[model samples]
Target: MNLFTDFESRIKDILETLESVREKRSELDFGRVNVEPPRDPSHGDVATNAAMVLAKPLGMNPRALAELIVEKLKQDPEVTDVSVAGPGFINVRLSVSYWQKLLSGMARAGVDYGRSAVGGGRKVNVEYVSANPTGPMHVGHCRGAVVGDALANLLAFSGYEVTKEYYINDAGSQIDVLARSAFLRYRQALGEEIGEIPPGLYPGDYLVPVGEALADEFGTSLRLMPEDKWMPLVKDRTIDAMMAMIREDLAALNVNHDVFFSERTLHANGAAAIRTAINDLTFKGHVYKGTLPPPKGQLPEDWEDREQTLFRSTEVGDDIDRPLIKSDGSYTYFAADVAYFKDKFDRGFDEMIYVLGADHGGYVKRLEALARAVSGGSSKLTVLLCQLVKLFRDGEPVKMSKRSGDFVTLRDVVDEVGRDPVRFMMIYRKNSEPLDFDFAKVTEQSKDNPVFYVQYAHARCRSVFRQAADAFPDLNLESVDLASAVLGQITDPTELQLVAKLAEYPRVIEAAALAQEPHRIAFYLYDLAAAFHAHWNKGKENPELRFVNDKNRELSTARLGLVHAVASVLKSGLSITGTSAPEEMR
Candidate 1:
């Protein structure tokens, strides 16, 4: 159970019973009432601002209302003491018995303890890592991939029906360049002495295998076809090969998408989807024929002063109305985006989230406006912009990879430092904040390294159980119920503090999911790890604080229950972050 949520319910119930509250019941709004852990642990177990928020509406003094609420709260059997602080805030100390019982529940629930129903089964589509299908995924796509995957995991854990998606940008000019690059490789495979790649072509050696595959499939036949005839065949094959490589790279980092929507689909059948979407907008008076003023600074190459088909996006939320079709009657890239959004809305997604790189920040408002215009404000849209990750090695900048031609591939990072570190460090910072990922620091076994520290905490928890097994060979160390029965012996303040941290997991998950910030989970996990490590260090100074005591089987078992709860929460959070909780660390 969520302790803060439980206490908030209890406090609101207490407020309802007050005579003053009954008089103003019809006018009262309890939405602002919430209970959270006290900012200073020394203050109490839980803190609330119920009096401060409700007193004005009730026409009563804040401190006077707090005292009244305190009296009713004092009657709660679970609450050991209740007090008023700072004008109107209320602090309530819970009994050790209450914490002990909560610990029992936590141990019984295991890793599933933090799973929540806050999302109410809302259908959320999280689309991320839509990197162009022209090449392997580089480090630039890595951060967004992990952020989006972790976010999907977080949302699912918090009870959302989450669909992880990848949007393939295969309909652009970049794909044409890829086909031309692959054709060169195919020629080279046939013993043609092709020189250095041209300025505009992809130069990576990763396409050598694709070239070989093309030779195996088409032999010398493809070389005889004209450019237009060969272009489509080569483009399709190259996209398939590149996506296969991209998927393999993503898999190496444990990222998998439920949907891989192709941009070409929107362009298929004479742009059927794009036409339908534009028609829908036209019927709604959101489509118009207009010309856009030249953009500030250097004009874009495609800018035309002549009139064209446009979407009245500004009427919804965009900064300016956007072009749908260019002067040449070709649909713009934004047209494909509109169709993509309509496709998602038609599929009955209640919310859509786009995980894009920081460079795509300009798309945020327009995408938000599209949701309003396309869904008629029925669906919500959110854009999470992940900042660039600067790579470093021992205080020096990392050089580019020849495998990727210019940048470090996602596989390069994963293969060198490992996937867990890559995934964890990618999420350790807020997505909107630039992250400096150092190869030397993340893999270090010290507490300064968050992933290692958090993983080590889980490993230590397992070690405790192993130690307990050897200390009491006859004891059923595997029985959560058995350990839970003896939790009353775990009365130390530090032990209870760990349980208090565990109790915050559900709250953290709900808050992070609502904020759409998975970094909060990383921050919370790190804090919990620090608290656990601190307590473990205490055992060295005081023998009584040891988790597995040979002289006291009952206390040891009780502590083991506490350890189980910590491990369960750590594993749960780590799983959400797409990092493994190892059984042991070498």
Candidate 2:
């Protein structure tokens, strides 16, 4: 159904035809040939680099090949004009009937028009928002959460078997700190005067509920137990409470994970999986015991050379060998990461995508090295490092949350600006690029706000349907049967331009999904919305361009069909980004 793909296929067929006419050129590879929209819309609707790609291989000059291809392409009934530009790029102008027919096909497809099967149903594991289960999710976790969720949605829409996962950092010392913090709150709950929260403990009042629940559950029983006995129980309870709070916060943002994988599971019960994975690495000669030089930069005063279990990460492209076990005979964080990746590999995931904070940029090489070592060079692991987001109010820096100490909680952002703004703004920029989210701008009703602008376009389309129904009450506008829509009547220049933008949607979805970049969807929707709004504004200058033409029901129905297609594409794109496309805006 994608016209661009259809054109590309046609171009390939022409190339095949040319190759058959000259069997000597059959050895040339057409794999790199590409068909896309020309840079300048004035040039053409669709463009191809078939001649440029085949020139050197066919032992023919680009312009000569392009002329031959253009001659063959002009014969196409759908291609109204064809020309060679620059070196060998072929620019094609399709007829209005072709665009009209494409619109008709789109109207029939409805919201499923842009769905693609490029992924071929391969399993992809997307892990993000793996914030430690020590407290509620904060603003730091917001970008990755939205990005990861949208990516999973996009992948699923593109035919990938996606697993949205959260890795719980519950096996770390942070969990112990959380336990001690909760214990203090529990003592206070029991009427003990626990004054001035300790320096190393979490002082957030969110833990008070966990403390009160613990006090009610065991009362004096836990208080009588030794530190070792009580600490485990306290840690488990605190992690559960914190994870519950995190999940609730995610729900507020309208995000959900298919699986919440625990890092502790790798090392629990005497490190079974960790040992097994390490043994597998050992069998592959990736593990070794080594003593090394001190860190390159300013060495620590207490730095000492010691033997430790190390992975030969450098052999697989890591900057340096990474430690697996520390001097205290405990597994390093990297060891747990390896086990986690191994678990995912065992689960039959063909691709593993980690949406991590930009601060973890240094960790990428080693993680990729681990993936290569663990999967025997078959695992495709991609890490998307999301840069920081700075919140602004009226152009001033927003202050931190007093409730959560130094950082702003994710719920705080969602509560203030609402979910749609939060989700949209999060991915409005590239993951590796920093974003500035302005509350004042996001909340504004004007078209300057992207989410509002896009939603308003959808609302306007719905508004058109309402206007059409009232203008022609007996038209039966609710029917999905757009076959009666006389698309040939949709010949207005501005209207054709809007439809042209709509035609780029499937290409946008396929490209964004293939690149694993969801921000492209956001940008495309903005452009589509802008084009739609421009067309809507055109009607104001000329009343004859109005969507509801009581004097001309044939053209009116055709225009409404176009509006319906726009709305459907908007809703489909919004759904993939986890944002709602409102039919009405209050």
Candidate 3:
């Protein structure tokens, strides 16, 4: 199934023969060797520079070493030819039967063709879209949601036991403000003339429905209660309503979390979980009383010389020790976060990934230090910083303002441009880089939009199938038999070139999974799509090259197998990223 692996194993056998003939005068170093597809097909199927890396160490000329390796590899029937190219590089041309056999394996494997066991059953917890429960999810949240969800899917496909988690910030002052805003709407729902919303309160029109619902349920009974009694009631109601809205926004983007850990639930009934986390740190000698020098560069305006309870984070690789408790004896945000991560470790996750906004750039190192310090360096944690997304409409940037309480929700963009374009563009680049989401350009059914281009290619293949069915009524999809046919019949240059891309699927999935970069899948799909489109368009110029030939049923059925494999892989990859592979373009 994996042609690259087959070539690598054959090359390793050659290395073994080279080792047997050596006199043991020097250490044989093949550690840095790598076998991969050459950038230019003219070079060969797989190329390696092992001889160059080993020449100086083994005290042999690189070209001589390469010649020895090639002589040894001539014994492998799988390697049709091995050449010493350039100074010491080895280029290997695998037998054409290797590729044809691979296509057969792919057809039999179906969607599971590229699944990997790279994770080896390691447990990983991925936390994403931990947006505050004060408002609905906006477009800024879309990128992180998709990246994190896709990352989880990628890891799971690679055999990791993965957990998709969302951290709810329900215990902060922001939630308090949300409650106050909801109380204002409750009064308005009661027909009270609560004028324009104050500057500090949420003013979104969505809150109006929440207010009406509250009035309908409580019947104005909370009006006479004191602020303290009503605060908790209002806070609970508002958070319940807001979290519901946030969930709907995420669903529109095709995201769902396995766990929704609420911050308030951590301290339910004043159970003192944050204190327990600090006390556990105390046993490890990380707790201390210290006055941090005013944060270098820009000090907070209220920075004072007050001694506070601090954690010796610098010992674990932080810039400096950080305050665990504020001057008023309340746990800071860092303390609660520490407790949450501890819970993750306790739940048996061997590795963890946190997806956060670029504004949280400073939080990465310190949070990592906390996780390491708590887990005694036994747990591995990685923080993926998602840079800001600048949304564009008609080539103009959309600005978000908290004052109007009307932001561009994820639902808004998905409803306007659509889900596939949004998912494709979000992961089309590194997550650390800022993205430009232009609504006008993404919806265009042109090559300019990558989503449409890939989907169009898949749809194009289906068109070929429909046309082939017309010319031949008995084409059996149940037995997509390409193995029995002489693959040499696919002699068109365009057909052979497209097969080269299909050959890369297994290796491509492995690399993308290993780097924890789902965006590479987006890039690979586009490349495959481009190759397919080129082959499709070339048929117009040469009628014999068309997938369906009225005169030759044998040639058409053989090409059908490759088309089926292409469409299947495209569908699986798109599904992993929560994108649909439509069967038609128009």
Candidate 4:
């Protein structure tokens, strides 16, 4: 259950009662309110901006509204005290019994404790890692893959019906390069010399297999055919091989998409989604043929004034209206993307998310505007920008260049550091910020690595359980029957603090999900780990304060209950971000 949501429902009831008594019909835009723990623990258990958010809209003084809400909260027995602090921010102090109930709820629901129905099972399409399906996915694609997959996981847990998708750029000049490159490999497989790949062609050794397969299939027949005749067969087979390679790379990081849409298929075989998108936009007055202006700073020598088909995205929110068709009468990359989003809206998904490289930042506003136009402002599309990744080994930079095709692949990183560390480190920084992935430090068993520290917290908790088995032979770590045996036996300040942190789990999940900031989860896990470590260290300082006191079975059970809750949150969070929580850290 979502404790914060339950509290919000109750607050709404009280507010409705007040409105009735006062004879008012005004709505309080409470949807924009936020509830979270204060940065300073001394302030209180939770802070809310209800008063500040509603004061101006409701035509009331901020301090006055805060005081009214404080009085309303104070009447509830669950909330022991409520105070207004710092210009109408409300701080709430709940009874320890409220925290105890949280642990009971966690134990009852297990891994499902933090899930909320905020999304109401609405469909959301997430398109990401739509890298050119021409070669192996390099390190540049890894960050977007992690962010998109983790976001899909988070949105699903928050009650969304999420569909992960990849858009293959198969119909483009790049694929023509792939076709010609494969033809060269096909000749090479036939013992011909195609020395030092031409500068305009793909040079990766991966095309060798495609060439060999072609020789096996045609047995010298294709060699006699015209270039155009062989282009289709070579292109399709090359795309198939490239996509298979990309899927395997994604599989290495445990990322899987629900669907794969091809760009070339958009206007091929008498079924063109792109043409349909343009027609729909044209019918809606969002598209037109217009002359474009020359560049303000520098006009190219080959520049000629011409008319072009454009989308009026600037009126909606784009900085400049965008061209959908190039001068050569071919669809621009933006046109394919518009069709992709329109397809998502057509598939009954009202929500769409695009995880794009940071270099594509300029496209965010236009893409969202297009989605708005196509779906008549009903589709809410969000674009997450994944910044560059800087790779370092022993504090030295590891250079990467994909065009040269000698860069590090996703598999290389995962194979070197394993999945948990790679996933955690990739998400430790906000997706819009560049990440410094130091190879030397990630694998080191030190507190500097946040992944290992969080895992160590979980592993230490398990060690305590193992030791408990030695002290209390009858105690079952997994026993729900022990609930009665553990109630109200916990007393240490450190233990109580840890329980309160666990009580904040549902709130943390709700906030993090709404913020679309998975880095917050990483930070929260670190704080939770700190709390668990603080209490564990206290046990070493005071042997009588230890989890296993031979004289008191009640205290042992209570402390174990707290330990179980800590482990539960760590496991839940790690699972959310596709990280693993090991029972032992060896």
Candidate 5:
């Protein structure tokens, strides 16, 4: 169980027993009162500001209220000591028995120890890596893909029903260009030279197979048809081919989506979905026919000076009103976005998250406004803009991949450095911060390589169990009942510190899921690995602190339980990050 959550409930119960607190119970906001690990571990096990937040509401001096809370807290059998520090902060030291029991619970839970129901089974839609189906996915899309996939995994682990989604931009003008590019390759496949790839069309050799497929299917018939007839067929075929390539690239990195929502579906049949969404917004008084003033900076390509259908986005949360339709009566790109979000809302999603690149920062406020307008302020919308990732090799900037024509394909990076390093290093830093992924650094089997280090910790944990098995052949390591194990023998300060780190796993999962930041998981795993490694090193210097004690079989078994707990946590966390926790480091 979550110790902080357990104490938070217990502390609130204690506050409710107070006559002063009961008098203002209706006005008191107990939500502000929370328990967390103390800033200084020496102070106590858990710290809370219960008295500080409840003091004024209860109409008592802060310290006086603290003393009252402390008195009630001391009555808890699990609490060994309670103290008030610096105004009204309460610190409670849990008994050693409590920690030992907690460790037993952790061991029994195994890899599922940190799984929580904090999300309450809410349906969350995470849309990421919706790259245009014109070419292979580049490294520019890698960060958001990993971040979004990990976030979805984190939310699911935290008990949320999450749907991982990808929006295919197949209905845009870019698709027409892609069709033309493929048609050129189709001609080349049919024996025409087709010398230079035009400047405007995609030049990647990746599309050559699509051309050959088209030629094999339709042969010279496509060339004889009118532009309108052939263009539609060509677009469909090329989009499918490109999406297939994209899927392979994503799979190589272990990223997959539950739904591949097509933009073409929204634009089909006279743009029915778009028109229906506009009418819904219009009925809500969120749509109007108005011209927009030229934006201060570079005017967007879709921005029109003439009167047009507009979304009154400013009425919700956007900085300026957004255009929904062009002067030619055709719907703008934002119109499709409005329809897409309405579709997600109609799907019964409680929350929608869009993981876009940093360049799309401008879309954040407008998307938030769209959610408010479309969902009528019921559904929550979040846009996480992942900053760019720069690739380097041994301190030198890595060059672009020639296979992708201009940029490094996600598959190229994954194939070169392995998927674990790519996935782990991509999220090693905050999504909002720039990440420098160095090829040489991540592959190194050193402490500096976080993925390797964390994996090594798990491998080391397994190694300890192997040593225990060899040292004591009679010991049943597999069926060692951790609940009845001699856990009290694990009294070393460093060993207890490792247990504390494991205790933070559930808290980390809940916090990261709530914040929609999976980088926190990566950061926490690295810290946990460092703690395990540090403890392992200490054992190297002091034989008595080692996990396997040949002369002390009971103590060795207890320590093995601790090692199993560490491995379980490491394996669980790595699974969430889409990385593997190896049993033995190669």
Candidate 6:
């Protein structure tokens, strides 16, 4: 159950009662009301702004309205205390029974306890880690991949029908470069002593296998073919091999996408789809011939003002008109993006989200304009810009890669520190903020490492349950027994504090899902883990507070049930982040 949601409803019920009692006063709308935990826990368990918001409109003094609301709320059986504070805010302390009941409900629901239906099964397409099909994924692509995967998992848990997608950048100048790069390797494979790789071509040895495969398939025949003929063949084979390598890297991090949409497909079979998308925009009067201003900053010496087929992106929300077709009559990258957006809309996705790097910040407005223009405002597109991740080892910056030569590959980090640490650390901060991932800190088995701390809390919860089973051999201690625990025995304040934190899990899931932020879950888990760990330490000082009580089996069962709830939530949260919740810390 969402405890805050329930309390909000109760508060609204009290307001409605007030409206009926004071008919002479103006009717006040409660739609904008809010119920959240107080900034100061000592003030109350939950705080509501209903009285403050409704007071002026209802022609009553704010304090007077708060008093009236408090009077009505005090009658609620679950509301043990109610007071008006700080001008008009209503502070409410729910009965201990309220939290106890929530704990029992959590045990009963287990990992499914925090699942919500706020999304209403809407179809959402989340595209991320759409790295070019030219080489292996680098560390730059790591954070976005984890963020998108975890956000997708979060949306699904919140009842959205989600499709994880990657837009394969296979139809760009970069692929031509990849083809030429592989061709050099292919020539070397066929006993030709190819000298130093050209400056623009990829020089990574990872493409050696692709070159070897091409040689095995076509022998020296490809060498004799014209550049146009062999380029296509080599590009296709090289792209496929590179995508395979990229998939392996993603798999190593436990990140996978449901759709790998190819940019080539947008212009496949004679560019029909690209033409169709541009025509649709033209018909809507959003396409026309125009010349863009020489780009800001460095004006190209060869820059010339000439007419080109342009999308009037400014008609929607873009800062300026965008080019759709180049002077050579080839569709531009933006044109292909328009077609990609159209394809996603036609696929029935009500919402489309692009997870991009911080460098793509300027692309957000144009993409948003395209979505609004293509869907005619029916579908929404949102872009999340994930900032860079700085790698560290023993407080020193870590850089360089064996795969790409210039930077670290995602596989390198995963291979060094296990997948769980990589996944958790990637999302331990907000996407827009830069993150520092330290090898030493993440691997440490201490509270300083959030990944280990949260996992340790889960492991500790399971450990206590095992201890309980051994201490009280007669107790069932099964799923049935735990759910049916006598929670009334949980009277300790520290024990209740942990229960209070658990009660907030449902609200946290709902809010995080609504905001499309997975980092919130990571932070919430760390806080919850800290609370559990603090309570556990308290037991070391007070023997009676220890969860496993040999003589007091009833209290032990209640404590075991609380521990079960904590473990269940930790597992659920970790699963969303694509991390594991170990049964044992070691």
Give the higher-lDDT candidate: 2 or 3.
2
Ranking by lDDT: 1, 5, 6, 2, 3, 4
Model 1 ranges with Cα > 4 A deviation: 480-483
Q: For each candidate, give its TM-score against the true structure.
A: 0.98, 0.97, 0.95, 0.92, 0.98, 0.97
Clashes of each: 0, 0, 0, 0, 0, 0
Task: Give the per-residue Cα lDDT of candidate 1 at 302.
Answer: 59
Give one digit per residue, the lDDT tens place, for model 6 in 1-586: 8888888898777776775435743455667789999999999899999878887777778899899888888888988899999889989998888888888899899999999999999999999999998888888799999999999999999999999999999997899999999999999999988888879989888988999999999999999999999999999899999999999999999998999998988878898899999999999889988788988898633334788898999989999888888766877888899988999999999999999999999899999999999999999999999999999999999968867867888998999999999999999999999999899999999889999999999999999978987897776765446766746777788888898898888899999999999999999999999999999999999999999889887888888889999999999999999999999967
Candidate 3 pairs with clashing backbones: none
- Model with the higher TM-score, candidate 5 or 6: 5
TM-score, cand. 1 vs. native: 0.98
Order by TM-score, highest first: 1, 5, 2, 6, 3, 4
**TM-score of decoy 4:** 0.92
Q: In model 5, where is the ten-residue run with the lowest total lDDT?
A: 482-491
- Candidate 3 C-alpha lDDT tens digits along 1-586: 7777766676666666675336543476555777788888987878987788877877789999899999877777767888998899999876766666677677667678788888899999999999998887877789999999999998898889999999999997788899999999999999999988999998987788888988998988889889999899989888999899889988888899999999987676663778888889999999998787877787754344688899999999998788888777877778888788888888999999999988898888998999889999999989998888889888888766453367877877888888889988999988999899999989898888899998988898788789887898777655656555536565555665666688788788888878889998898889999888888778888888888897999888878777877888888788778788999989
- The candidate maximizing lDDT is 1
lDDT of 4 by residue, 1-586 (tens): 5666666676666666665324443555657777777778888877888778877767788898888888889889879778999899988887767766666666666667677777788898888899998787877799999888888888888888999999888887889999999999999998899889899887877788889999999878778989999999888888999899889989889889999988777767543788889888999999988867886778633233677788998877777777887667777677787887888888999788888899888678888789878988898989999999989999999776444367877777887888888888888999989999998899999889899999999899788788888888886667644434445666556666887787777777767778777777788898899888888888899987787776887778777777777888888888888888888878
Q: Best candidate per TM-score, number?
A: 1
Candidate 2: count the clashes: 0
Tens digit of per-residue lDDT, candidate 2, span 372-437: 999998879999999999989999999988778778899999999999999988889989899999
Task: Encode model 1's per-residue lDDT on 334-440: one tens digit a residue.
Answer: 99999999999999999999999999998999999999999999999999999999999998999999998999999999999999999999999999999999999
TM-score of structure candidate 2: 0.97
Task: Tell me the spans in candidate 4 whose CA falls farther than 4 Å from its real position.
Answer: 1-3, 6-28, 32-34, 49-75, 86-88, 297-304, 326-329, 400-404, 482-486
Location of the lowest summed lDDT over 10 successive residues in candidate 2? 299-308
Q: Name the regions of candidate 6 deviating beyond 4 angstroms.
A: 20-27, 299-304
- Go through the candidates in order and give each one's C-alpha lDDT: 0.93, 0.90, 0.83, 0.81, 0.92, 0.90
Flag clash pairs in model 1: none
